[model samples]
Target chain A: MKTETTIQGLTASLASARSSKKMIGFVPTMGNLHEGHLTLVRAAKKICDVVVVSIFVNPIQFGVGEDFDSYPRTLEQDSRLLAEVGCDIIFAPSVEQMYGTQPRLTNISVGQITDDLCGKSRPGHFDGVAVVVTKLFNIVQPDYAFFGQKDYQQLAVIRQLVQDLNIPLEVIGVPIVRAEDGLALSSRNGYLTPEQRAIAPKIYQLLKQAEQQLRQGEMLEQVLANISTELTQAGFVVDYVEARQTNLQPIAQFDQDLVLFVAAKLGSTRLIDNLQINFKT
Target chain B: MKTETTIQGLTASLASARSSKKMIGFVPTMGNLHEGHLTLVRAAKKICDVVVVSIFVNPIQFGVGEDFDSYPRTLEQDSRLLAEVGCDIIFAPSVEQMYGTQPRLTNISVGQITDDLCGKSRPGHFDGVAVVVTKLFNIVQPDYAFFGQKDYQQLAVIRQLVQDLNIPLEVIGVPIVRAEDGLALSSRNGYLTPEQRAIAPKIYQLLKQAEQQLRQGEMLEQVLANISTELTQAGFVVDYVEARQTNLQPIAQFDQDLVLFVAAKLGSTRLIDNLQINFKT
Candidate 1:
């Protein structure tokens, strides 16, 4: 697989691909590739004529006190993992390459849904995502763009952006790929100490139990409060523990399919996880 | 010439054109086609295999008391004019079709430059233009998009939007078309009374005199003050009389190529005009 660091090089390659009647699928990531990212690439390869994966550690998405500086840059290592999964091209543009020296004057913002969840905690995070994703979408001009459902709010934001803007591409959300211990796979997971890592799976475990409790007709508020308290006792500073509609709308009582989401701090590292509950099925 | 009012229909037609290797050019207008708009269409026909013109009276762009409802939509007449100019398709989606019953969650904003000029008077105007233009760009997926330089700030906003977002199409700024008396052609001119129409040319006339005065080493502030006084004396409520660099940067003294811009109201009808002075040439 070839890697392109410049927009011109990538567009030149894509122009030929388009002329040759190739259906391009794009997977955008901040690459410190784990199993989760590979699954997105593999899924793209299964359906598209060519799969282009973008590994941009978008600095704008991270807030002032967030992990922008410490975000991993493992392109060389990420490249090998992507090749094994049959990625056709790796677009790894530098900060200067993606965004020039001038201040970014253009901003894309999604409302309502972005005001809660991760967006509330990290202000302007989803706007950063929307803008960078838009630039990538314009640059790659893919037939299908794949995103991980692990970032449930992000996926929702992208879906809204695509629909609202009438962008001519399908947005596919791949299911979250998790570890054997049920911890959701994320590049930031690399920041955890070994002792902190051992305690990480508790998040997924609590979500699963919460899902089962809700299925058994447990009160929504009671279940969430219990989960929040449980996380605090387990040494995780709970950011939020709540259930919402699949679209991230607030739910007073779950009557239909919903998702249970949690975000908390374990030491200096923050981790998030969610579980979808399908009651009708 | 064909007209499509739905995104699906337009995309299908574009898909067939793409298969047959056609280069699509786009001109986005707010209907009520005048000589200025015809010039844009004619320019598109010169360089593209197919030219698609979109006539959308975007509601979001209009302020609370602005003339959105009164915006003249001369589609039937406009269609005839376009056909005469060898236009290929007219994509005129209804407001409901363009934006569903749900609120538009996505917003595109350009900073700094949008804080002054017309942007100051008409808040959120450039943002509305940015979002809708982005939507049209994504939906039509054209090779080249045209805009009239008559709306100087708007053209600058679009240029900055395209460059900042790295949208994959060339943005062409067509020179403003004027009448025999030098008044810049605009659909809004239809709002004028015969007496008001007679006074309209004074805007362009003043811009020309200002250009000559600046060229002959007249003091910049004095020249603008005299033009403002002349416009007010002609029964216009002068909005602004100023010179700025070609990129719309505020210029204290015009030493190089700059544009003189004027906006004024006469009997509730507002008109805007500009003249570019090329000192370097």
Candidate 2:
């Protein structure tokens, strides 16, 4: 396994790999690797000839009061985990390396989909995700770029971004890694206190209720209302509980590709989770 | 010369051409190929082994009220001219072929430079240009993409966009093709009446004067004031006459790499022109 800190080195390495006919699979993540990140690495190893993982916490995605300053950085542990997972190369570019200078006030915005769930609560969050993803894409130039379904809407936005921008890469979505108790895995889960951790699973439990309602042939409006009430009663501030069609258009009638999404605040930190409720067998 | 209407045909053709390890130079033009466009082809032919010219009047770059419907499109004449200029392949795609059904709304925007100048006058003009150029970049994936410096700010924006997005192509700005009397060659010149064509050189002349003033240690304010008076006296509606940094930043002093830009309404049509003036030169 090789590690490169400079953009030029990683880019040359990737280009060299390509000329030699090695398929590259990439997992771009902010540092502090957990079991969830390792799952992505292991998946990349299984398919691609060369598995490249990039660990850089993107600061542009964070708005004024967000956790950019306090976001965890565990590069040593993260590097150790990648080495264990048979990773081919790791690109760890510093802030200066990622952005030569502050990118002059530009943004990449997807329409109502970004405006609906995570976008509404975080404000400029998806745009930040977009610009950073574009930067990483330029750096990694991976054949198959992987994103865990954990950040489900982010995955959706990225899919649209690649498609809209005509980016020549396959956007592969890995299923959400979950705890035994069904809580979705996220790096931000570190911010939760022990007591808050206990209640975190309840948010997923409420989402499951919304999923169950859809399974039982309940209408989207009733399912959304039921989930909203459930989250409110659990002492979680429900930002929005929406059941929409696969393209994220509001459900006038249920389609087999409907997705139920939730975003709420636990203590001072906000977390989001989503499930595709109506998958056909 | 081979003419391809689809991306697959062009790619196959270009790839086969590339098997010989030849350097490809591409010129992207909205067809209605005049002597000006042929000049770019001649330049491309002089240096490159493969010269690919794209002829498609991009619809997205024009505003709703703008002259997309009225824009002159001369495909037949363009093909003959390209052939005469020793062009290798002509890649022309329909809007549907270039943009897929589920067009991704994620677009590339280059910042403040677009915000002022032409961007302010024609709303979403650069957004359209950025999006269409991005589509062309993806479709053609040219080794070298060429643009004329007649659209001066556009050259700067494309340079920034390609760099910012990490697009793998070289953006080459060819010097503007000028008429015998020094009017910048443009497709929009078709809109000019006979009398209108006679005085079109005034726009270029005013910009040159501003450049001379800045070179001789004059303030931008006084230079702009004179240009505005000149245009108004000539019966053109002066839209904006401002002196800005070469990067399109507003200037507080008469120093540094400077550009004097002007846009005005001549009858119902809008024309923009600029002069690159380096004060310290």
Candidate 3:
């Protein structure tokens, strides 16, 4: 597989494939790819005539005081893993290449849904995602873009962005890849210490328990409070434990498709996980 | 020439042209078939293989009570005009088709430059333009898009938006098309009564005089004040008369390419005009 760094170079590589009407599948990820990202790439390979994986750790997505500087950069190892997965092109652009010396004047804001859940705590976070994803979508012009469902809000934000802007492409959400102990795979998971890593699976476990309790007709607020208390007791500085509909709208009582989301800090590493549950009533 | 009223129809119409490696040119308008718009189309025809004109009276771009409901939409006449000018396709989707029942969650905001000039008076105006233009650009997927420099700040905004978003298309700004008397042609000119129409050309006249004075070593503020006073005395409720660099940054003294901008109301019709002057020094 060929690797290109500049936008021109990437577009040049895709020109012949595009001219021939090849179905281009794209997977955009912050570098330091793990099993979750590979799953997205493998899925793309199964469907597309050409698969492009973009590995740029977007700086704008990180809030001030967030881990923008310490974010992993394992290009050499990441390239090997992507090659193994048969990625046709690996686009790795420097920060300067993506967002030049000039301040980016364009900002894309996805409303309403962005004001709740992860968006509520991390202000302007989804706007950064929306704008950067828009740039990536335009640059790559992919037929299909695969995003891991681990970033459930981000996937939803992208979906809404694509729809609202009428960007002519399909957005495919891949199920989250997890470790044997059920820790959702993420590049940020690398920030966890060994002990913190051991406790990471508890996030998914709480989501699962929350899902089961909701299924058993427990009160929504009670279930949420119980999960929050349990997570706090487990030494996590609980950020949020809430239940919402697929659209991120708060559910009064789980009567439709629901996602139970949880975020907490295990030391310096903030971990997030969600479980989707379809209610039949 | 094909007239498509839906996004799908327009895409289907252009698919073959796109696959056959034809260069697509786009001109987005609100469809009153003015000379200024036709000049843009003519410019596109000269540079592109297929010219697609989108006649969308974008509601979002109009501020509340700013003539959106009463804006001239002469599709039948506009289509005739386009065909006469060798236009290939006219994509005119309805507001319902463009926006749909769902709320458009996406908003594209361009900063700094949008905080002044037309943007300052009409808040969220450039943002609306930015979002709709983005949508149209994606839908048409043209190799180049044309805009009239009549709305100088708008052209600037689109140019900045395209660059910041890395949209893979060229934005060509066609010079303002005007009547023999020098009123910049606009669909809103339809709002002017005969007496108001008679005085409309004065907007352009003032801009021209201001440009000449600034070139002849007139103080920037003095020239702007003179133009505003002249326009007000000529029966206009002057909005603003200012000078700025092409990038819309305020210029204390003209040392680079500059634009003298004017906006005023003749009766109830608000008219705007600008004249570009290249500074030799």
Best by lDDT: 1
Local distance difference test scores for all models: 0.92, 0.81, 0.91
The native-contact fraction of candidate 3 is 0.95
Off by over 4 Å in 1: B252-254
In candidate 1 the C-alpha lDDT for residue B192 amounts to 96
Instruction: Tell me the tens digit of each residue's lDDT in model 1 across B162-230.
Output: 988889899999999999999899988999999999999999999888888888999888999999999
lDDT-wise, the better of 1 and 2 is 1
Give the lowest summed-lDDT range of ten residues in model 1 chain A.
Answer: A247-256
Per-residue alpha-carbon lDDT of candidate 3 for residues A1-281, written as tens digits (9 for 90 to 100): 99999999999999999999999999999889999999999999999999999999898998989999999999999999999999999999999999989878889999998887789889989988987899999899999999999899999999999999999899999998999999999888999989899888988898888888877888888989998998898889998887788888777554788888898999989899999998774
RMSD over all Cα atoms, model 3: 1.2
Q: Could you give candidate 2's per-residue lDDT for residues A136-208 as a string of tens digits?
A: 8866778788888878888889999888877768998888887877778888889988877888888788778
**Residues B179-241 of candidate 3: C-alpha lDDT, one tens digit per residue:** 999998988888989999998898888888887787788888898899989988999999888
Measured over the true interface residues after superposition, the C-alpha RMSD of each candidate is 0.8, 2.1, 0.7
DockQ of each: 0.88, 0.57, 0.92
TM-score of each: 0.98, 0.93, 0.98
Best by DockQ: 3
TM-score, structure 1 vs. true: 0.98
Better of 1 and 2 by DockQ: 1
Clashes of each: 0, 0, 0
